[model samples]
Target: MTENLDPREGSLTTRPTAADRARALLDPARCRGLVPHDAGYLQTAGIEIPATRGFGQQLMRTRFYAGVYQLGRPIGLRVASALQAPGRDEDRARTARSLRLRPGHTVLDIACGPGNFTGTYGHAVGRDGLAIGLDASHPMLRRAVADNPGPAVAYLSGDAENLPFRDGVADAVSCLAALYLINEPFRAIEEMARVLVPGGRIVLLTSLAPGGRRDRPHVMVMERLSTMRMFGRDEITDFLRALGFDEIEQVTAGLAQTVTATKR
Candidate 1:
């Protein structure tokens, strides 16, 4: 699933072959009156994609952005964690376990780059359940459609600040290593809370903040290299507590943090 490195091919073309299949994963009633387009995804109107610009945005639109993790090396989990700890294979399993999913439960994967975990979630939920991946990047969504095709899975173009689904549409929601990329991450988490049903599980993996702030080019370069936002956790933890989530917990791995909670 590596994208073209050739400068001439800045981005991959959107293939139509999987559009029909992805369409089947959408529930008519679940959409906020937005129809799935011919390119094989529903989108939030006026929402810009890639979330970022320049190098990082280009990287995410391609397959190599994730660059591996505890269980997925090369594009979905902790890159440093995979390299420093045991690499790629345990990430998805741990995430699934945290969700405590059951067969036939619907799941929404926000910021699902390349739809990597979308396919994983689909399998976890089984045939009767639905797994929907949402990302603002068209190339990522198109590539996701090509890379991960399943009867129970689909991809859409949407902004994290405002999820496009109606209230309480998902039994579980997972956002992995993507919240930091959004401008208003806590607001996005609130949106995740809005789409989830009562007692539903939520899981997130994001870049961990450094112990203290610093004014240094080295730190800035490191942040760019890893696509991490070196912001602290007071806001996130406080927000979760205010939301009345149960079992809220956060764990660190390499440069990443895994946060799990349940809607009240």
Candidate 2:
């Protein structure tokens, strides 16, 4: 059954005590979706998240997670961007334009670290909407719950490649700057397409190989260090086309690319 969790269409909410939010989230039998700290988000009856995560995410924990993410993310992006398109904070603008969310829309943010974008999605969707953020890291989810609390937003600890939601559950799907971290990115994209309603749009940001070259020394070195999948230009674009997506638009900033398309 679809849950209506959002209390309003507003800015980020302050962190409340576990007992405060538990009244709305905890169902005695299912306990499926609750606050991240108290119930660890979606710990339902049959769910098991036995999947791999990126080395950086695996290395982060509650102690220093927030600091690292808030401080380090931009630096990393800047360095990566320096290698290719060399633009400033284009991710936020590109995504905001592509999503074009209306009230009550459900947006699934795959690999949503810290639920940052997820909460924004919730605000965009307004009172009768849902924004589900799925990530395989426990620390990330916990931090997210602390930082980005909302009635409309829910965080789940799960694999991006193996989502738990039913088909056509979301109006829009997004995988930002993290698709390359998944062990099976193509499978993850397929699952994203499956869960989205036809005509629903998708926004993706991932690393593209320089001149589609992974055989280069520097690229190989970085790949060995981070275990990030470097995609070719046509790789994801072609895959989306085959998956029956249209109106494909790609915006490149440095080594990363943002792709927006509608599911046919």
Candidate 3:
């Protein structure tokens, strides 16, 4: 439900009514651990939210637009899958080919929404290997757990910037179509590097602007609504190189790019 705002007060007003604060404090989602516990009361109240925060936090504060996406997660994911079926299949095949996964190779899939690529990774790794799909959204994790069931596949709720894994524990790590949504892309990349073994592959697929064109309408909307920002090919390569990654290769498909690098 939308926040209960006073009729006399303008939308931009920083001061929230007592009822608004009370409603935010009593929201079940916040207490149920669906949202971050440390979020400020004003944020939870959906008033005067700052722009310098993670997309997950912003989504949580809004309850995914009054539970529209949350309630219809399966349908939303199905629609997304249908719309991107060909591209998603191609990306998965490319990733599978590039990673050349073997039996008993541990793989981590960050921001693995609905286990789209995570299941592919699991099958690639086979039963002997582990495939963990990690995402910050609880509903997404639930969908992933329900849809991608296997002994080798598991789902965990975790932040991409701060992965919940030991150092150099993975044979491969992948983050597909999600880096742009992260507030701290560098930190997330560093975490991916930290969890990867030497020579392990890191696969990333994300929206990119060719020739530094960041003025696209969709990009601007995402920036305003979710704090997302597009990256260039060279910018990403530089980040990878600085983090000890080598042999970086980028392949563009439409507005997104698939980047594969090896940890050195």
Which candidate leads the pack in TM-score?
A: 2
Name the better of 1 and 3 by lDDT.
1
In candidate 3, stretches whose alpha carbon ends up further than 4 angstroms from where it belongs are 1-86, 213-222
Global lDDT scores for all candidate models? 0.70, 0.72, 0.65
Please state the error at residue 191 of candidate 3 in Å: 0.3
TM-score of each: 0.75, 0.79, 0.67
Sequence-dependent TM-score of model 3: 0.67
Q: In model 3, which residue pairs have backbone atoms overlapping below 3 Å?
A: none
lDDT of 3: 0.65
Candidate 2 structure quality by residue, lDDT tens digits, 115-211: 7677778777775677778777777777777777676777777677767666776889999878887778899999899888999999998897887
Candidate 3 lDDT over residue span 1-264, tens digit each: 234445677454344332232233232432232232322111122212124366544564353442354345434433434434244466577787777677778888887766767788888877567777767665555556666655566665567876645677788999976787777888989989998999899998776664446767766765677566677657788899999999899866445667899999
Model 2 weakest 10-residue run by lDDT: 17-26
Q: Provide the global lDDT of candidate 2 against the true structure.
A: 0.72
Which of 1 and 3 is the better model by TM-score?
A: 1
lDDT of 1 by residue, 1-264 (tens): 223244567766433322343343434554433456666666754445534744555566664443322124444443545444333346676787789878888888898877777888888888567888888777677767777767677777878877766677789999986876776788889989988899999998777655433245765777777565654555466688798788899876656667899999
Off by over 4 Å in 2: 1-40, 60-63, 83-94, 215-218
